[model samples]
Target: MQVISVNVGRPRPNPGKGADLTGIDKRPVNGAVAVVVPGPKGTGEVGLVGDRVYDVKHHGGTDQAVYAYAREDLDSWEADLGRSLGSGAFGENLTTAGVDVNRALIGERWQIGPDVVLEVSSPRIPCGTFQGWLQQQGWIKRFTRAALPGAYLRVIVPGQLRATDPIQILHRPDHEVTVELAFRALTLEPELLPQLSAAEALPEEARKRALRRSSTG
Candidate 1:
């Protein structure tokens, strides 16, 4: 697999969800972009050098430092929406080709280019800001139902990466908690939540939710 484009957010006014600004307007950038581990959540810090999230409470942090989506998935969405969807249109930092991002297991490690290493941590959860950005009615429901929420990654080895960088699957955790499975469990199917406990690399918030569901069940 390879990276189709490296995107960075361009801050824009967001009247939706009461956030003054949103970084959902990501555009492809040329040249190498630094990737680093961000601090905790609620700081708006992301892995990319110039990109950050405005919805601090729900986005960013080390667990969600980078978001990646497959070009194939975007193409599917384009066909469904009858519009052109380019790289970063979904607020993802990396648009990849030949990669089944949703099928990637939590804690899977990928080596991008010759340096950067990122680990799958969670699945991107659609929010009000995303729905507003797309201007599609019931977009949140549509995206959730699709269960192609993409993958959120944490920087394992900080370095530089750019468009067309080859991606190598360095490691795959011995678990079945893929990004799609996590999204389904977190959103529509609470019964699957108990299975997420097998993925120890899941973010603290998601892990706790899974734990709660397991205890209750």
Candidate 2:
């Protein structure tokens, strides 16, 4: 697998984004970008250099330092939506090819290029920013039903990343809680939240969320 494009966000006004000043507009970059783990949930820091997120409370953190989406999945969406989706259409940092990103295990590790190592943390959850950016009616519900949310990753090893960089699976946790399964558990199938505990290596915040939901249920 390889990176088709490395994207970073650009600030743009959006009245629909509520109090947030910027809309979700990410564009592909031409050269290498640095990837590093951010500090905390409200830090608004991300792995990719020059990439920014307007909503610090919801978007950036160590748990979501990077977002990756498969070109194949985007192609599927393009066919279904009857429109073309360029790289970074979903606000993903990396647009990848030949990778089953959604099916990746929660704790799987990917070595990008030669230096960067990113661990799968969670799945991207649909938000108002995303729906407004796409201008799609009922998009949140539609996306949730589709259950194709891309993967969010935490930077385990910092390095530079660029388009066409090779992606290697350095490690895979022995867990059945794939990215898709996590997405489904969080959004569609709350019943499965308890099962996510088997993915011991999953990000702590995500694991706690699942266990909390399961216990409350």
Candidate 3:
């Protein structure tokens, strides 16, 4: 695993579109190389500590050649150019390798630094801000629906992360409720709720959401 790039950020809106249009640079988050967290840093399996940046698909994206987001669709589907299913930019803080991050279930963990271990929380969803980042309309929606279930991670441990460090898949949860499966089942199939309920680590709040949404959609 190689360090794709080191991304730092500040409190800002969506950075760019498809790693091309978002003009915001990801070098300084509120003017610090890193930041401190109360417990852990972020929500997804990979956490953005200092500046709120995203570690998108690993191998690459639809745009350009390869990408910084470590987890790529190569792990799940067939993509020739090595693209992230998410139309993301290159400002991800830590790029990872050797893992289909979309398949990372909740309760999954990764040892980021001596002091930082991250946990998978939820699949990264598309939002309106992504449109602004890419300078196009419906970009976020298309990516979320088409290519992948981009993910976010919460830092379980807090330490320093320099660029070029190796990203290791330290742990994988035993549950089979992958983010991709849940995304499809939650959005397309409600009969899978029983399977979801089988996840021993499924959070109560998220389980409620799943059950409620399944009933309606």
**Per-residue lDDT of 1-217 in model 3, one digit per residue for the tens?**
5333456444354444333222223552322234244322232122344433333332111111111344455234226324443312534444456556667675576665445555665555554445565455566655556636545555556566555455666777767887666655555455666556555444454578666755675
Against the true structure, what is each candidate's TM-score? Answer: 0.98, 0.95, 0.62
Residues 60-91, candidate 1: write the lDDT tens digits: 99999999999999999999999999999999
Cα distance off (Å), candidate 2, residue 16: 3.3
Best-matching candidate per lDDT? 1
Indicate whether candidate 1 or candidate 2 has the larger TM-score: 1
Sliding window of 10 residues with minimal summed lDDT for model 1: 11-20
- Backbone clashes for every candidate come to 0, 0, 30
lDDT of each: 0.95, 0.88, 0.48
